[model samples]
Target: MGEHAAVAAVDDPVTVDRIAANLRELGVEAGDTLLVHTSLSELGWVAGGPQAVVDALQRVVTADGTLVMPTHSTQYSDPSVWSNPPVPDDWIPQIRESMPPFRPELTPSRGMGAVAECFRDYPETVRSRHPLYSFAAWGADAESIVADHSFENAMGEASPLARVYDRDGSVLLLGADHASNTSLHLAEYRADLDTGRVTETAPVLRDDERTMVEWTDIEHDSGDFPQVGAAFEKAHPEAVRQDDVGTATAKLVDQPALVDFGAEWMSDHR
Candidate 1:
């Protein structure tokens, strides 16, 4: 069956209360800082859709807890490297010149899904300033977490993922898998596994002028994230918890534990 057909087969509308309850069952607490990676469709047609999912997360985390999601604008990067439906070589300069500067309020997420897009639209959310690797956060500690995302190390020790790791936060995989677990990128940095570096350029609004800037950042590779995650689960089963949120499977894992295990695993395996 096709993806939409499978979803239609379930057709059960999930509500805010139900989502919140399921989150609680997945080990989310009242004052937890959660980095969520979600697939809205897997939640079985939420009543209010992405907004309802965001509300449910907020309800569970409450005002004291912080919520975070990757709002990366990958399209903001250099057009010269575009591969999927790549523009003609002659158009690279034109595209770069015309590319709009990254705006926290207006720049839309490319592939982060409906839930993250909705969360980014949240009025109280604070987004990182990085043009390509921005992250949106809300609630307590949000500002401190996303305030300084280093352009040179987008997912390294200088990024929001580092703060989440240092704060002993949790990762909530709501119908998403290890591939979407961005925290793993931190382990790649920690492992110092020679993932290489890539020089990327983007347009940014600086002093009311759109300026094109270039920076060399560590090339983050998630090719083995699934394998690493499987190894992590095997090594630290106690730190990982699983449950259901709506019809979607949910995983709650200790960020620090995963990173620690992942660093070690990558060092030995990668």
Candidate 2:
């Protein structure tokens, strides 16, 4: 949505304090480890935009809590897998060779939105090492949540998703649906499905030098995520808390329950 339209849609400016209050009402508590997925535009006109949203999250969660968000840089992956405006076949090798290595501190996340991009650069925020599916985190356990992000199985056991699961974290979907719920990928890893592996290459910094590394990992698909989420919500309605944060619909989910249910659901159906 455009700026003028967004401004016209809201009766009052959505301030940081307002967003924080909305988040608190949505079950976000102090010291809770939360993984957030948000749409800045969906929240309508705001007094401070993405930064205000981030600030509100921090205010609710506090420094004792942990905050996480996907900072994926799919553009750093193999050009062969590129379909959204795919490059020429001859240019693949050239792009790979010339592409800068993924630097957690420098490489900007692609398609992760303004809020995430801002969160990544926030003070004390640390990002994982996965070139394609890195996650940025802040507050307590920030380093541990993003630590040891394996090159293979970027969203599986060794990934930050698992760390969040270990911490009994919750997921906050601000104007995003189950399709954007990345925790389901952890279920895909555990579910009894033949998610075949694909060999992918990415440029990484090795001893402060650029080097191309290859790994094989399960090919993730989100086509069934929305359906799985709907079923889960139906089966466990009480676990999914729905409310309004700003002008956008928000949902606070129990991560472990959803992942457990998702694993069983995908195993039986898919």
Q: Model 1 clash tally?
A: 0
Task: Please identify model 2 stretches exceeding 4 Å from their true place.
Answer: none
On residues 81-134, what C-alpha lDDT tens digit does candidate 1 reach at each position?
A: 889879899998888888899977789988999999999999799999889889
lDDT of 1 at 192: 44
* Best-performing candidate as measured by TM-score: 2
- lDDT, model 1, position 185: 91
The candidate that wins on lDDT is: 2
lDDT of 2 by residue, 102-148 (tens): 99999999998899999999999999999999999999999999999
* Per-model RMSD to reference: 1.5, 0.7
TM-score of each: 0.96, 0.99
Q: Score candidate 2 by lDDT.
A: 0.94
